[model samples]
Structures are given as structure tokens and as C-alpha cells.
Target: MKIIRVGEPGLERPVVVDDAGTSFDLTTLTADIDGAFLAADGIATIRRALAEGRLPTVDVSGLRQGAPVVRPHAVWCIGMNYAAHAAESGAEPPTVPVLFFKTPNTVVGPYDDVLIPRGAEKTDWEVELAVVIGRRARYLDSPADAARHIAGYTISNDVSERAFQLESSGGQWSKGKCAETFNPLGPALVPADELDAGNLRLWSRVNGEPRQDSSTADLIFSVDYLVWHLSQVAVLEPGDIINTGTPQGVALSKRFPYLRPGDVVELGIDGIGSQRQRLRPA
Candidate 1:
């Protein structure tokens, strides 16, 4: 099942996209797609509803797509998790996963306009596969346990501002990562059972030129390991999002020009779908 949230921001209605690409309103089953719903076996419940033929189909032609899940409990990011990306940034691959956070407010619909923060000059883009947590996880026994806690997957553009991230902020990457609209997420949330998180092709393009083209197979820390690793320190709650990390070929690599107002960016992971964002001045 491909779950989605549709409508204007702050007023999105839960919906599910069928195999035929038709959308059905899910409000009759749940109010919003959030932590409480996932924690309560929401997906199972939705399946039951579908089997009973109780869900109402809706016309999504003119509605805007919101982030598939509502604001997660937290938005955690893995830094330098891709070997080539780490190499591009001139850092050795870490023996452990490097972590960071993008505040919840930074999340917006996948197609929303991304704002270049005021006075910002080193803004950048990253294409990452984001994991949505389905169960509360703390001190998991092993990476194998990680799969049961995953709800689904989606695409994210981990937009960054290089100067704030590296040069002026004393090495805190979140400083550059927490700007409004910095995280553009979702066209739909493909359930864990429906997609394989590993071995998927992911890519990003600025305007019409390709910049990053890589695979999740290149992740230094696999999704299972990341979930298990993070659970040992912080409690992983349902609806929490973990950005698995981006691949090589970002403006930060100095191989491409930084984004400016009027530039359009597009990115996607195979099967999950694609998203496009227009750069706009703050």
C-alpha cells in the first residue's frame, strides 16, 4: 500500500494509493497519519478496512500532496554514510554512523518550494532515502530486529547550507540543515513489505542537469544497522524519520554550482516516486 496525505498544509487528509494508482480517502479509518496511528497497528487496520470495502475513494487531481506522515517525533539524519559522499567532503568513512538532526519544522511536502534562507550563499541539495519508524524501539538486540520497527520508506532531499554547516558554525551540520523547507519529503509512503530498502537507485538533478546518481547499496551504514545503532542511545518512537544519508554529487563537493532562486531540483528513489522543488528567495 502507498499511503499519502493530501490537501493544503495543516489540513491534509490521509489517503492510500492503490496498485492502479487510484487514491482512496483514509479519514474513515484514521484522522491523520502520525505516531499514534502507526503505533496502533494502523496499517493492519487499513488493510482490514480495504478488505471490507469500507474506504471511500476520492479525486486527488487538484489537491496538493503533503508529507505522507505528519510531523514526526524527530527528524534524524546520518552524515557521511555514503563512502563516495564522504570522500567528496574530504573525510574518511566513519567506523560508526555519524548523526545529525533536522528540526521537524524543516519538513515540507515533496513538491513544495524550498526557500534559500536570508543572506545564505552556500545552499546545497542531497538526495536520501528516508525511513519511517513504525514502533517504539529502544536498545534493540540486533540489526535483525530493526526491520520489524520500520513502517515504510520515502524520498528526501536533505537540503543544506555549507557555510553554516562547515565553516561558520563550529562543525554543527544541523545549523545549515534546519532552515525552513530544508527537508522536502514524500509523494507517498511505500510500506516496508512492499519495497526493499537496500539496493535501490537514487538520484538528484539541479534544473535539468544530473548531479548525483547512486544507490542505497553504497550506504556505509545500512538501514538495519542504523536503526539498531540509534536505538541503543535514543529511543526511536513511531513516526520518527531517519534520513539514511545522501550520495555523492552535491554542491558541497564544489563540482556543481549552488542553487539559486528560480532553479528547479528533482530527486527520487526507485519505486517510491519522485519530487520536484523550485528554489525561491526567503
Candidate 2:
């Protein structure tokens, strides 16, 4: 099932999209889509409600689509997980996953305006597959155990500022990744069973021009392994988001000019849907 949140920012209401592409209001059943709801098997409850024909379809024509879930505990990211993306950035595939963090406040509605931080001159874009955790996971025994802990999948634009990330930060990427609106996520949160996360096509475009175009098939560290590996060091909790890296073709490789004010960026992953953000000065 595809789940969504719609309304003005911070006032979003949970919603579910039916097989026919119709959206049904889920506010009567849940206040918001967050860790608490997922931990309680909210998806299963929604399914039961649908089967009983107890939900009311709602018109969402003019509503703003908020990030599918509310503020998560943390937003974890895997860097250089994609072989081609690594090559483009002059790095080799890592023997272990390269993890990083984007402050939870960096997340915003998928279609919201993205601000180019003041004094930022090298802002860039990365289209990645984001994994949302559905349960607590710590020191998992195997990668195979990851499936049960996953809530679903969604799209994320891992917006970055190159100068802060590479030149002035003394090597920590988080300096460039945690700016407000740096992570634009969702249109919907699709359940794990509904997506083959290992092989979807993801891409990005700046003002209608293609930039990054690649597939998850090239990931050096797959979703399951990243999850299991992360659990060995940090507890992965419900509503924690993992951005599983990006494929080649970002402005960071010097293949395209970095984003500037007024630039419109569009990006998405197959099945998970897409998002558009207009750049503005912070």
C-alpha cells in the first residue's frame, strides 16, 4: 500500500493511496505517520480498514504534500555506496559502508522550495533511495533479517554544498549536508513488500536538464547489508531514515554546473514517485 501525508507543512494528515490511485483519509485512524504508528503495525491496520471498507475517500487536489512521515529520530546516510558515483568523485568502493548523518531538521516536503544556504557557491544534488525503518534493530544476526525491520521506501534528494563538504569542513560531510531543506523526501511511503529496492532506476534533473541517471543495481553496499551493518554499531529505530547513497551524475563530479537560485530540480526513483524543488537564496 502507498501511504502519504497531505496538508500545509507541520499540519499534514495521514492518507493512504488505493490501488486505483485514489487517496483515502486516514486521520480517523491515526493522527500522523511517525515511529509510534509504524511500531504498532499501522500499515496492517490500514489494510484491515480498507478490506472492511471503512475509509472515506478524500479530494486532495490543492493540498500540499508533506514528507510522508513526521520528524524521525535521525536521518542516516551511506556515502560512496554506489560504485559509479564513487568513481565519478575520484574515490574507490569502500570495504565498509561510509556512514554520515543529516540532522533530522534538514528534511522537508518533497515539493517544497530548497534554499541555497547563504555564502554557498557549490550546492549540488543527489537522487537516492531512502529506507524507512519500521522496527528497532540492534546487532542483527544477518542481512536477511533486515527485511522484517523495514517499513517501506521513498525518494530523497540528498542536497549538498560542495565547498562546505569538501573544502572548508576539514573532511566531515555533515557540515554540508545538514542545512535546512537539504533533504526533500516523499510523495508517499511504499511498503517494503511492494518494492524491489535493489533494482530501481533513480535520476535527477536541473531545470529540465538531465544530470544524474543510474540504477540501485550498482550499489556496492546493498540495503540489507547497510541496515545490518549499521545495527552493529547504532540502534536502528522505527522512523529512522537511511539514505542509501546515489548513483553517478551529480554536479559534484564537475559534469554539470552546480545549482543556482531559481533553478528547478526534479528527481525520483521508479515506483516510489518523484519530487520537484525550486532553488532560492537562504
Candidate 3:
């Protein structure tokens, strides 16, 4: 089952899409699609409803699809999890996972306009696979158990500004990463059972040209290990999201290419879905 949120901003509702491509309302059944739903045998119940022909179908068009999950407690990110990206960023592969935070408010639905901040000259784009936590995970060493803790997967654009990221305040990356509307998150949150979080092809294009393109197989740390490693340091709550990092083909990788005003960014991953966002002047 592919779980999603639809409606306007705060009024979003929980929904599930069946194999027939029909969307059923899960709002009346669940207030929101969060850790609780994923925790209480949600996938099985939805599948059962579909089998019984009791599920309702709604057109996916018209209504705005919000991020598959709402206000995730934390938005954790891994920088340079892709070897090529690490090389482009002029950073060596870390001995362990390198983590950072994107404020929860930075979260926005897929296809939303990515506002290029005023005076920004280094705005960039990154196509990444985001992981949604389904259960409380902590200190698990085995990668095999990682899949069990994942609720679903989604597409993400880890938009950034190189100047604020590398040159400002000496070298704090958050300055470049935390701009409003920086992270455009999901087209949908596909259940882990329904899709392969690893091994899918991912790509991002600017205007009409390809820029970033790679497969999840290129990830330095697989989703399972990243989750397990993170759990060792903190509680992995339901509804939390982790951006597994981007591949090498970013603007930062190019010698002199960067997004200017009026650039459109299209990004996607197979199975999860795709999103196209316009870059607007702030």
C-alpha cells in the first residue's frame, strides 16, 4: 500500500493507494498517517480492506498531496553518503555516519516552489531518497532488522545554497541548508513492503537538462545501516524522516553552474514517484 497525505497544508488527510491505482480515504479511520498507524498493523489492515472491496477510491488529481507524513519530529540528513558527492564536496569519507538536522518547519510538499532567497547566488539542488521511520529503533547492529523499522520511502530535493553552506560564518553548513522551503519532500510515502528502498534509480534535472542521476545502489551507507547507526545515538520515533544523501551530479560538482532565477527542478525515484518544483525569486 502506498500511504499519502492530501488536502491543504494543516487540513491534510491520510490516504492509501491500492494496486489498482485507486486512492482510499484513511482520514475517517485514522486522524493522521504517523508512527501510530504504521505501528498498529496498518499495512495489513489496509490491504485487507482492499481485498474485501470495502475501500473507497478518490481521484489523485485536483487535491494537493501533502508530504506523506506531517510535521516529522526531526528531519535528519546524511551528507556525502554517496562517494562521488563526497568527492565533489571536497570531503573525505567519514569513518562513521555524518549527520545534521533540517528544522521540521523546512518541510514542504513535493512540487512546491523552492523560493530562492534574496541575495542568494549559490542555490543548488540534490535528489535524495528519504526514509520514514515506522517504529522506535535504537542501537540495533544488524542491517537485516533495519527494513522492519521503516514505514515507507519518498522522494526529496535537498535544495541548498553553496555560499551560505561553505563561505558564510566561516563554515557552518546549516546557513546554506536551512532556508525556508529548502526541502520539498514527497510525492508519496510508499510502504517498505510495497517497494525496494534500495536499488532504485534516482535522478534530478534543472530546467530541461539532467544534472544529478544515480542509483540507490551507490549509497555509501545503506538505509538499514544508517537507521541502525542513528538508533545507537537517539530514539528513532515513528514519523521521523532521514534524507539518505545525494549522488554526485549536483551543481556544486560542476565548476560554474548554479541555479538562477526561473529555473525549474524536476526530481524523482522509481516506485516512490516524482516532483517538479519551480525556482522563484524571493
Q: 195-253 in candidate 2: lDDT tens per residue?
A: 99989999889989998888998899899999999999999999999999999999888
lDDT of 3 at 82: 89
Q: For candidate 3, write residues 1-282 as lDDT tens digits.
A: 678888898998888887668788876567888778877867667778878877677776798878888888888999889888899988887778888778888888897788998889889999999999988888887888888889889987988988888887475677788888898989898878777777999998888898877999988999999999999899888889999999988888775389987889999999888998898987
Kindly report the root-mean-square deviation of model 2 from the true structure over all alpha carbons. Answer: 0.7
Greater-lDDT candidate between 1 and 3: 1
The candidate with the higher TM-score, 1 or 3, is 1
TM for every model, in the order presented, reads 0.99, 0.99, 0.95
For model 2, what is the error of residue 222's alpha carbon versus the real structure, in angstroms, after optimal superposition? Answer: 0.8
Off by over 4 Å in 3: none
Collision pairs in model 1:
none
Deviation from native of the Cα of residue 179 in model 2, angstroms: 0.6
Worst 10 residues of 3 by lDDT: 167-176
Which regions of candidate 2 fall more than 4 Å away from where they truly are?
none
Model 1 ranges off by over 4 Å = none
